[model samples]
Target chain A: MSSKKQASSQLRVGDNPLVKWLLVGLTLFLTAILLVVPLIAIFQQAFVEGAAHYFNSLLEADTLHAIGLTLLVAALTVPVNLVFGVMLAWSVTRFEFPGRKLLMTLMDIPFAVSPVVAGLLYLLLYGNNGWIGAWLYEQDIQLMFAWPGIVMVTVFVTCPFVARELIPLMQQQGREDEEAAVILGASGWQLFRRVTLPNIKWALIYGVILTNARAVGEFGAVSVVSGNIRGETNTLPLHVQLQYEDYQAAAAFASASLLAFIALLTLLFKAFIEWRQERQEATL
Target chain B: MSILIEHISKTFGQFQALSPLSLDIQEGEMIGLLGPSGSGKTTLLRIIAGLEGADTGRIQFGDRDVTNLHVRDRRVGFVFQNYALFRHMTVADNVAFGLDVLPRKERPSPSEIKKRVMHLLDMVQLAHLANRFPSQLSGGQKQRIALARALATQPEVLLLDEPFGALDAKVRKELRRWLRGLHEELGFTSVFVTHDQEEALELSDRVVVMSNGYIEQVDKPGDLYASPNSRFVFDFLGNANVFEGKADQGKWLNQQASLQLPKGIEQQDGQLYVRSHEFFVSDAPTEQANLPLKVVAINPIGAEVRLELSPIGWQSKDIWEIDLPHKAFDQHGYEKGQTVFVTPKAGYFFADDLAQPTPLHW
Candidate 1:
């Protein structure tokens, strides 16, 4: 009976190793096919013609303008989102006030709403004869088919990223440290700049990375409000779509490759920031 | 400076954290608020430090009413239980935080702040750790750094809540002695809150035993220990043998047992009390005072042997404890379940009047 029990235990333990390896192999296979294969395909397509052609086409005026506009949007949206996101996070976590729950739910609305709905909502509010747009149009002020319209859409799309990242972190941190600072005679501004800022610095950085990535990659929202004006409102993602529609295969793939490269860099940055934060929290 | 606390009360929702309590703290005295958890020791200390506000009361610190004052404006130093050292700052910077908060007109120069920080660090014997962050230090080191930080501002009063509560046994013992020495050297008016009876007994100039948001007794360490004003203080301070017998005129009687009442216990009910070490074995009855007893358990604890005796006259499991020296036990050769007569030491008073239980544990 003992030998039979030992044999069954041995079989059970032996079966797990094979199962574990099989699961690991399955994961690797899927990752290779889904992510790596597409990346390799894009790289192959970019260099199919020639490195010289790829390099020459990258510096084209249209491509340059599209890249510039995408960069401009990311730069504009990230800092504003960073500040507002931190303030909202602070309010939700540090202060108790009326309508706190409502404010929190409102902050998360952008995350749950579809990007298409977001763009459509902006159009309804800011279009030529819609809501406040008619009054602006009477004064010859244009929002739709403009950079301001594109920026507004990008901000709306990326707004929740920073605050979402910070809220949970600030909540976990509580108000003990800030209270300690206050009791130690630190002024309100000094308490924020010193005690509050340093603690949430990494989370804020992570949020900014997520915001900038989304802002750069935003296509649905920008496409609707930008009116797809060539060389003017044509951001990189929109430019890639335009190139694809125009049947400029190589150029389309080339710009798509650039967008993918930027995304890859952002992902790598996000990973690094997360790793550092984990290390800091472990030490704490 | 005298601190007069008048009917201070703090209530959180339906639960009363501190009731209408009044106390007076004399200047240059190290007072200990001794109690168990949730006994309002910490709440009282925080109220004194201006970290907490009493719902209905006034607090006078040296003729200046500080009931509504902010913690910083109270000019009081508070050392928290977990040390609460700011992790981002170096030891010197942590100590210098309060000093640096001074207005620019009254702020000390860089050299003076450095010198003072170093001086405080040296006082805590942690000058070597001045450059290290709080994360790099051990629990004991962190506590010392906290003490130094609290002392940096040179406040009028110092408050410590469970100063050694987070430390290990050996470190806590060493720091207890070290803290006593520092308190003596500093000569600051300090009030420390602790649940450890041994800590309060060993360190305080005056120990105030608190229970259920009220002060049970306040006296010097030796006086409180020798004659605890309540049963809670007695049990909390040390072990004792309590006999619940009534003193009728000059004799005490309960059930079928009877013994002569001591001098001070003539007028009290439940009037028999004896310290563990006060009882002694006697084969024959003593002329004036004696009791017949049976040894039920012999518990030897290091150099002292605690003998538990069952009452011979009383028909119950009422056990009395007697602590004899190891040599005395060896000389007597007493065994468990042995019967003998014992006489309590002379002048041992009946403590029935002070045997009321307080709602505090140690």
Candidate 2:
């Protein structure tokens, strides 16, 4: 009986090596074709004109403004979304109430809908002759083709990032630590700042990073809202499109490479953060 | 301080988590709420800690009516089963959390907070690890830090919900003893929830045995052990050899065995529960020997030998286990497949409170 048990319990190697190798080969092949190829092509095209030309294109006044506008939009959108996301996640995950599922589904709307649809939805709400837009326009507030419009669309596109990252994590963490803090004489805000915030900080950062990336790189939505006004409301992705349309191929790829670099950095940071978290958990 | 819970009750949707129950915990008393998982022990603890509000109840902490107070305002310290320490905070910061969160006017100075935190860490014997985050601490160390944090605010009452439930057996035993010592030193009114009857009995000034959202009994360990009020308490507190039989005119008889009842005992159908150690075994069947049993298995566990027996005219269902001292076993020369007559040394008979026979499955 013991020998049979030991025999069954012994760790078995791959039962079918062919299937294992096939799976590995297929994954690597698909990854190379889909992800690696596009990444390499962007850099290849950007530097096809010498490094000096690529740098000169990057330093162009319009390109600089587009980069600045993208950064400003991301800077503004990320913080707003970060606050809203934390509040949304906290309310949904920590409290039990009627219509919580409905609220959660609403939060996920930005993720489910196309960015173009999201921009259109905001436009309907705030465009000239639109619902709230008509009243706002009568009050002399320009929103449809301006910076605020760009920001509004960015916010809508990135709304679910932080909350989506945090909700499941906070839910899994449960209410014990918060309850303990409360019992230990922590006020509501103190409980949140001390206990809840620290627990969800890493997830919050991960969410913010993704949200910032999306806000900077958002194309379809920002395009629908911004009117593609150069040096004014054109974000980096829209700027890339404008350059491409104007036959400024070197400039477009150079700009594209910048966004791609940001995406790569975000991916690397995310991987590092996850690795660190895993290491910490392993030590624990 | 003493806590008065008046007719406390709670329900989660259709499930009643706590029935209308009242308990008075005196100042400096360490009370154990002992029960199975669904028995509302943890719920009651949470209610007292003001972490959960009772649907209908008035709670008084000393002279103050704290039933309507927020958990923070109630000045109750709570320790959770999972240790619930702030994962990102070091041991010192965790211990200082309660004090640091106090309103600015009431908050201690930074140096004062540091001193107090270190003092608490020293008390828990974790001062050496004060810089370590909760994740770096062992389960036992984390729990001790939790206790220290809960105590930092000088709460009027301390409540723990299965505080050591996440720990291994050896660590649990060590922490239970440590908690007992700490409770004695601090002299705070405390109530802890635990399902382990031995833990409750060993560590509590008094144990409140609960079942199905009702308090079954409350007594000192010795008293509760000797005099369990209900069948649930009797079964939950310790192991028992339960015999179901009908008493008739100073004698009791079941399908497979007969025993003489003590004189003047009422004639009634009931179950008799005897602790294993309360049964005597002998080689010969005398008048005092009530049941003739055939020993089927002898399990030696430390100083005692547990004899698994079947009645002489055994049906498949008729089996009894009795524990004898190893010396007694040796003296009697008892072995498997040998005949021995057994009699109850001490036991309890509950009228009409028969234990349901456990079905045997192969």
Reference-based TM-score of each model? 0.81, 0.90
What are the per-candidate TM-scores when only chain A is compared? Answer: 0.93, 0.94
Question: Which regions in candidate 2 have their CA more than 4 angstroms from the true location?
Answer: A1-11, A15-22, B282-298, B308-320, B331-341, B353-362
State the C-alpha lDDT per candidate.
Answer: 0.83, 0.87
Fnat values, one per model, are 0.23, 0.98
DockQ of each: 0.35, 0.77
Among these predictions, the greatest lDDT belongs to 2
Residue-level lDDT of model 1, residues B1-362, one tens digit each, is: 56788999987678788889888888888999999898899999888887778899999998898888887678777888877777788889999988888778878999999999999999999999999988889999999998888888887688898999999989999998998888788878889999999899898999999888888899999988766767667657755666666667676566656556544433556545567777667776665344667888888897899888888766433468888999888898987777777666632343455545322110
Question: Over 4 Å off in model 1, which ranges?
Answer: A1-15, A96-106, A124-145, A167-174, A274-284, B231-362
True contacts kept of 2: 0.98
Q: After superposition, how far is residue B181 of candidate 1 from its true place, in Å?
A: 2.2
Q: What is the TM-score of chain A in candidate 1?
A: 0.93
lDDT of 2 by residue, A127-240 (tens): 997899999999999898898999998898899999999999999999988888887788878887878887888899899989988988899888998988898988899999
* Per-candidate total of colliding backbone pairs: 0, 0
Please give, for residues A23-125, the per-residue lDDT of candidate 1 as tens digits: 9999999999999999888878877788888877778899899999999989899988998998889988977788999999998888888888888999999
Candidate 1, lDDT over the whole model: 0.83
